[model samples]
Target: MKSRFTPLLAGLVLAVSSLTVQADEVQVAVAANFTAPMQKIAAEFEKDTGHKALLVFGATGKLYAQIKNGAPFQVFLAADDKTPAKLETEGDTVSGSRFTYAIGTLVLWSAKPGFVDDQGEVLKKGAFKHLAIANPKTAPYGAAAVATLTQLGLLDAIQPKLVTGENISQAYQFVVTENAELGFIALSQVMADGQMTGGSAWVVPSNLHDPIRQDAAILAKGRNQPAARALVEYLKGDKAAAIIKSYGYAL
Candidate 1:
């Protein structure tokens, strides 16, 4: 009986060893607004690293809460500099691994044809009854929306006509669903397949708001994970920067 069991035990050990060798998949927490580009980048990352990326996409604030609760995210790709800075202050990150991957843009987007215009002067004209924005308290895109309005001197004038989404991605959904005639959303949300959507958009002027410097950082969970660090460095490379630019983000 002992002799017969030896072969079975040896086979089980080999199977476990094989599985362990392929378990280098990195768990990444990405902002929801970055869903599209991150998908493309991950494909490239896998091709180069032979390590798969397990991406979790959502609002930066919500992801922050999840991380605080010990979610197994090995790294964070946040839409704002604030959250990553906070995490580092709290000692939740691997020291010296944080860096800005992209500068995001906010746009006044609409699904209805001819609704938006080149310079976005249509907002002052009040062509649409409602304007959409992400919740300014949590989503960085939301803050950009507010800044754009304030910079255009229309925030108070259009206060009553504003609708809000919990996150920038949801704000885009509001416009798509016609819940709001127009909403402020991340540029990537409307740029699909390397093209802009049907309606016109005025990419918000960068000077109107604080720069949306999207910071990526390795979590404490990935302290010794070279793949996580390599992934961050990979993003600064030519291929990844191209992916980032194709999505309407500035690297």
Candidate 2:
């Protein structure tokens, strides 16, 4: 009887192991500024870790609202540290699970070649008909853009020309589509291999605004999830860091 039971137990253990090895999908809410890098990280994560990350991109504030209202996302990659910290405080996230994954940089970019000056003198010149920026109320990058303008004492003057987008990705589109002459956007949106891929841009100085310390956290719904934890760890790994750095984000 003992010998027969031992074989049955071994078979059960093997079946459970096989189930664990099979990839599990984790739903992730990602900030728009991290779009390109997140896409790359998700592909690599699935390939190397046998876990699938189903990513949804949007403004951090909007994503936070969704989470508060019980969105089924297991992981959140925010564009700023504040939103994750807030979620942790609100008991919406797994405690002690939040960490800064990347430091984002902002840029003023335009579709027209040589339209934006490196020194950002174009803002003062104000020749363009429209200047696009993300909605500061919802997008951290947009808040940073506003902060930069305030620091330079140009907020009031630039307000008349302002065209706001719901998120940084849309703000970038406004400029790239030439709907707005120029726009404040994430450097990663228009950069490749640490250089501007097209048109001209002014890489905004870090001192101009608060550091965009992007953070990632596991949500309450994901507290018991192995696949969610795996994604959080994968984001801190060397491969993910390299992909993020290549997109102009600092690890």
**Which candidate ranks first by TM-score, i.e. highest?**
2
lDDT of 2 by residue, 175-199 (tens): 9999999999999998776777899
The list of candidate 1 runs beyond 4 A from truth reads 1-23, 192-194
Give one digit per residue, the lDDT tens place, for model 1 in 1-251.
79999999999999989866854778999998899999999999988877788899888998999999999999999999999999999999998989999999888788987778878988989967888898888888898889989998999999999998888878888899998988889999888656896776788889999999999999999888867877888888999998888888887
Stretches off by above 4 angstroms in model 2 are 1-21
The deviation in Å at residue 205 for candidate 2 is 0.7
Model 2 worst lDDT window (10 residues): 190-199
**TM-score for model 1?**
0.88
lDDT of each: 0.88, 0.94
Show pairs that collide, candidate 2.
Answer: none
Distance from true location, Cα of 112 in model 1, Å = 2.0
With a 3 Å backbone cut-off (N, CA, C), the pairs that clash in candidate 1 are none
lDDT of 2 at 90: 86
